[model samples]
Target: MLDAGICNYVAISYGHSGLWGGGMRQLLFNTRPSEACFGHFGAVGRYALAAQRGMHEFSSGPETWKHIAMGQRKWANLNPAAIMHAKPMSEADYHGAPLVVEPFRLFDSCQMNDGGRAIIVTSAERARDLKHRPVLIMGMGQHNPSNEIAQARYLAGPTGAHKAGRAAFAMAGIGLDDVDACQIYDCFTYTVEITMQEYGFFGRGEGENWFQGGTIEPGGTMPVNTSGGQLSEAYFMGLTPIAEAVMQLMGRCGPRQLGPETRTREPQVILCSDNGGALQSHSCLIFGRG
Candidate 1:
């Protein structure tokens, strides 16, 4: 999502409206049938629960479980700033934690904190002169499913994420295999798990396995949520993933840097995902070094 309200207005107008008058009105007043018209809440946990319940049926096997736990551990390790940090946990820890919602727990829920981030977008040439090298916005896509979750056909699949990924890959002229790392919005653990599958990072039911074996850590095959994410990092209206993707591309991530040793190359390509309102809505963005 755009950081400012004005950005939404500009997007609704397809960059055609004047600076502050008609565009703003069209965006704020118009009730157009667009993805931008819908919104939702409780994104992370609910999706995880739904995935576990076989509501969407991608993959929820032992491998998937292990990957998810491993990713959580890695996130805890890299993010000393995280609330769950220093609390050694294991598969047993996840299983034993009191259930907040079936298949989720207090720890499974994302941390709530206060923080702010800012980003500047310009041409790749101009980006070089800024504080850091500009990571090009090679591809970006956003989507919304039916607003009423009850009517949604696949709870686990997240049709919106699937569609968004396809659009992003098409726009960037890349594919899932091309991304070196990812920064998925993990308002809840399941959000990440489900996204892994929906974005084509893994086979339908294989996302959980991707999370296992430390696949999503700094040194793993496809490091994800490198900034601690909403799971361990602060929550800022769901824009944190966008900022993290920008940082990863700039090579400015300090403690959570995912260097070449982890994935055999600097993270030249990244995929970022976001979910809105109980996983009711989804968005994906792709970035790369030009």
Candidate 2:
């Protein structure tokens, strides 16, 4: 595509000016919206309905939020570009903080802020010739279940990420167990927990157990979102997370870099995910050392 377009680089980026709404914006706005916000999927009632359908109940969801928050904070310190890099937080602060929705503390909800992120995409041949080490896009996939949460087939689970991940893995010729690190979507801390489970990184209903002992921490077996993700990093509609993935794969993250796993073992694969619309749509990407 780049060759055909006569373009050497293509940039993928997303920016939000949530506070900006001119007259043109109001003109397109509907007084009665027909669609539900993606947040509806993460709401408590949906979780309850999912439990009723025998999907593993997220009873321990709150506990997992703490680990994510703390783990993200630990890395935020190393990311100079992160917004929360200076604001340290601990499990105490997470629990003591007010709840956004029951079971979801304030820390669990991603804040809306003005931000922008960009990344350039080029042909593999062109990338290889570049001065810096290139981050290879091994495989990618996308899936959509429905536009409306009301039409979701499996409210208890089934975020469509599994299908996306499976397709990407097949294309990458890898397995879920083979992913060494992840930059999964973290619109809400629970999003990360659910994604890890749906993608088979952690056994169902075992998020809390897996996170214990810093399994997802820096240098841990399954380090995740090492750039603080949307939780602490500026949320750019998943663009920032994608950028972080490329950085980590290129081994350019100075302090936020994964611990030297090479002493005992070497990791050359990393996975990244982006979600759309109440978990109804998704995409996954795999990076490899080439």
Candidate 3:
């Protein structure tokens, strides 16, 4: 519609009900009879299990995921809208969480919530007249591999974010150093780790060192998932991260807001990622202050 100049503004809305009795697994993973018997079937646990060995070796061990899960939970503690906002967690608490899948504790998985969200998109000129600070879309990229996770190339290998992030950075004419924050898709804790590594935020096998010691949490050098992310906040799929990035850039999130007002470095550039279908599909969007 924008390409045809049919409208100058667009409103995107998304809603889902994972909390309801509806069976999302059946809906999303409708596999053929032949594919049903495959090793990677049904829920995401199997897929994560297949990659756990390489992930543990590359990122050090299962302990590395604790940082991601705990960090985001802390962020959630400060966001009233977050599902986990009232639930505070500690390192000890993270360690004690029961295993949902091998190498993945209960905290590693995102919760399903029923909610609706909407974001408005308009031309820069039109946005300038709006009440709030306009978040500019600097660059965007998407990549989806042809093969399934059963393929050797995809299982425990590079994700679509590798290429998608490169294209986004190239289009934006910026390096990883320019990113002030990240709103990485966190359907699972390890998802954030892999996406960051693929985006070159850290070199191969350096995720453990980079993520440890509260590097990506509030008051850390680079705050990530400031709205608590899908892991702690309500999961709305890709919308969770994308919406949070906009609020952060606009300096609108109260209490958990990122900016000089909160004694945190003002975010000028934000990187957002949306991963889908067992890391096979990825979309990278770079947003800048407008």
Candidate 4:
């Protein structure tokens, strides 16, 4: 587009400014999700809990969420402005937390805090002229299904990442093996676990083993959500993950930086996913250092 004399740059931003203070309660009440609703349409807590519980046969166990909480909390310590920065978490704390809904502890839920985030798009030529090292957007893909919760196939519907991720990989001219890190849109701990699989980070139904040995933690084989994400970081829909990906590619994430364990090194390619409407809308982007 820049070559065609179109726009020079594009910026995408989102704000849950309503979460700034008393506004959080407003979100819970105003969204009008039913208490009995499941999946994306009901009260956030009850729905996410119920959906995961019904699929117990695929359970990754409590430790799955525990690691997610632990890793994200560690990143929180690195982020002075993270909502959970002042509150550290431990495995004991996760185990002790009361269940807000069956199969879901309080720590599993995302923090509903006020926040804003943005991403910028520009041509490679303009990027070179710009001050900061540009994070190249190598690939993009999206897919959305209109099925309602009641009408959708259980555990079989395309929450879309399958199609999106495949398309993204195709467009990027790379395969999943090339991705070194991920910035998943984690509205809940399970969101991270499930999405990683759908995006082809590992074989289907292998999350239990795939996540073992700190693979998703800092300095691990494949780092994920290094900013703590919606679980321990502020939630602003998908923008937080998008911004974190930009920072990761830019080598701007301070203590939470990934790649090499003891030192800061940027990944050559990172995959970021954005989800919406009860996992109905999906978009995947691959960013790289050029």
Q: Give the TM-score of each candidate.
A: 0.77, 0.85, 0.93, 0.88
Which prediction has more favorable lDDT, 1 or 2?
Answer: 2
Top lDDT: which candidate number?
Answer: 3
User: Model 3, residue 130: what's the lDDT?
Assistant: 97
**Per-residue accuracy of model 2 over 1-290 as CA lDDT, tens digit each:** 79796888998877766447343233223222432243332333333343333324555466766898888777776789888889989778988998655556678766556768898899888989977678888889888888665677855456778888889999999887777788888877777877778888777778888887777777677877888888887777778668887877777887777646322124488899988655768899998865
TM-score of 3: 0.93
In candidate 2, stretches whose alpha carbon ends up further than 4 angstroms from where it belongs are: 3-6, 18-60, 261-267
What local distance difference test score does each model get? 0.66, 0.72, 0.82, 0.74
- How close to the true structure is residue 157 of candidate 4, measured as C-alpha lDDT? 30
The prediction achieving the highest TM-score against the true structure is: 3
lDDT per residue for candidate 3 within 1-290, as digits (tens), equals 76578999999988877777475555345665677766334545545664575575575446778889888988899899999999998888888888766677788888778897789999888888999999999999999985465563654447788899999999999999999999999988888888888899888788788988888888888788998899898888788999999999998998988876445679999999997777778999999999
Give the lDDT ranking, best first. 3, 4, 2, 1
Which regions of candidate 1 fall more than 4 Å away from where they truly are? Answer: 1-49, 55-66, 260-264
* Model 1 accuracy (lDDT, Cα): 0.66
| Candidates ranked by TM-score | 3, 4, 2, 1
Score candidate 2 by TM-score against the native: 0.85
**Candidate 2 structure lDDT:** 0.72
